[model samples]
Target: MQAFTGSTLYAAIGGLHVGDMLVQLVFFIILLILVKKYAWGPIIGMMQKREEYVANEIEIAEQNRAEAERASKEAAEKLRQTKEDAQKIIEDAKHIGGKQEQEIIESARQEAERIKISAQEEIKTEKEKAIQALQDKVASLSVLIASKVIEKEINAEDQEKLIDEYIKEVGEER
Candidate 1:
């Protein structure tokens, strides 16, 4: 009967043993807080710096993408402008060639007109000379015919008088 009462007393006192367990739990929590304060600050700072670096890299990549797009647009504009300039140059060349051709044609026409005028002048001069020669020949033939007719009709005394008058007219002309 006494052994049974001692066991019952032990069971009643078991609740008081939980006081030591609570003290142990409080000590563990204090140790955890001290370790976090000393060790965790640098780790968290390193993680924050890593995150900022990654964010900066993403920003740089985005900027590079925008720059590439701008360069591509500039290149396209340059190509288009070059093509337009080339077309304008070709048009200008064509216009200049056409103007030169027109000038050449006009020059050729003027030269031909001058040549035709020169040929006409030469022909007119030749015709005048031929007419003068024909007139001289006709005068000589008429003189010959008149001399023959005079020789057949005139008498000796009249021939002598006519000869003397011709000599007097020739001397006056000289």
Candidate 2:
């Protein structure tokens, strides 16, 4: 709305302070140079160190995961092997038990056989003694009958009575 004039625009912004503006500019340039020289390298070094630390941590995590997987696999394999060994031990125990059972049965059977043989031998010996006693009884009976008959003739009834008396005498003596 007003007439265009350079001086009036400059006066509105306080343009006579241009020398102060230049001094402020020079001060800003010096500040920037000082910050770049004194602070930038340490800040960059700190950032690089942080990056390397993070990368190392990630690599360690990966290695730990792999180690854990390998350990788990090894544990599983050991478990399988332990189970197999236990099975083998069970089988061996069963085999030993069976063998012992068989041995015990065989021993019992042999003992029974020995007992039977001993009993048979004893029976045979008893039978022979009984037969000998019978022969002796018969011989004594014959001799007594022959002597009685020679002394006096015996009828059938007398012969029967004599035999009964001899049997009684033999039984009492034994």
Candidate 3:
């Protein structure tokens, strides 16, 4: 506990070198200014450029993704349209096939009917021919029997006329 006079306090604080302290403070401020102008300025500029690049890349990626989604939707719509077209075509084909089948059946039925009518006409013609031959044979037998019984010969024209008249009479009786 000695008395702290100005001279004794200065001696106790190791003689207080103000000039050296001021010189050291000025150098430290100069060092800080140099670091701010050279190193810190470049570092801040590089960080800003890197941020802008990253943002641009993100925007491009988002645009690409949206385009991909639009393309996928268009492809799906085209596929649906194609399927509808195919279904319509199949239905039309079936309808056409049914119509053709009906036409074929009708044609076949008409052909069969025509054949049946032709066969009936042929049978009628053959029957008429057989009946005509039978009438001729009967007329010949009648003429032969008449000639044998009368012992007279008749002319051809007279025999034919007689047979026609007899056939007419028989038809009228029936």
- The TM-score values for the models, in the order shown, are 0.63, 0.78, 0.64
Clashing pairs in 2: none
Question: Evaluated with TM-score, which candidate comes out highest?
Answer: 2
Q: Please, what are the lDDT tens digits per residue for candidate 3 over residues 56-99? A: 99999999999999999999999999999999999999999999
Worst lDDT 10-window in candidate 2: 9-18
Cα deviation at 150, candidate 3, in Å, is 4.5
Clashing pairs in 3: none
Q: Write the per-residue lDDT of candidate 1 for residues 89-108, one digit (tens) a residue.
A: 99999999999999999999
Q: How does model 2 fare in lDDT?
A: 0.91
Winning model by lDDT: 2
Cα TM-score of candidate 2: 0.78
Q: Report how far off residue 119 is in candidate 3 (Å).
A: 2.1
lDDT of 2 by residue, 1-174 (tens): 999587887888877667788999999999989888889888988999999999999999999999999999999999999999999999999999999999999999999999999999999999999989978887987898789988988889998888898888778867
Model 3 stretches with alpha carbons more than 4 Å out: 1-29, 145-174
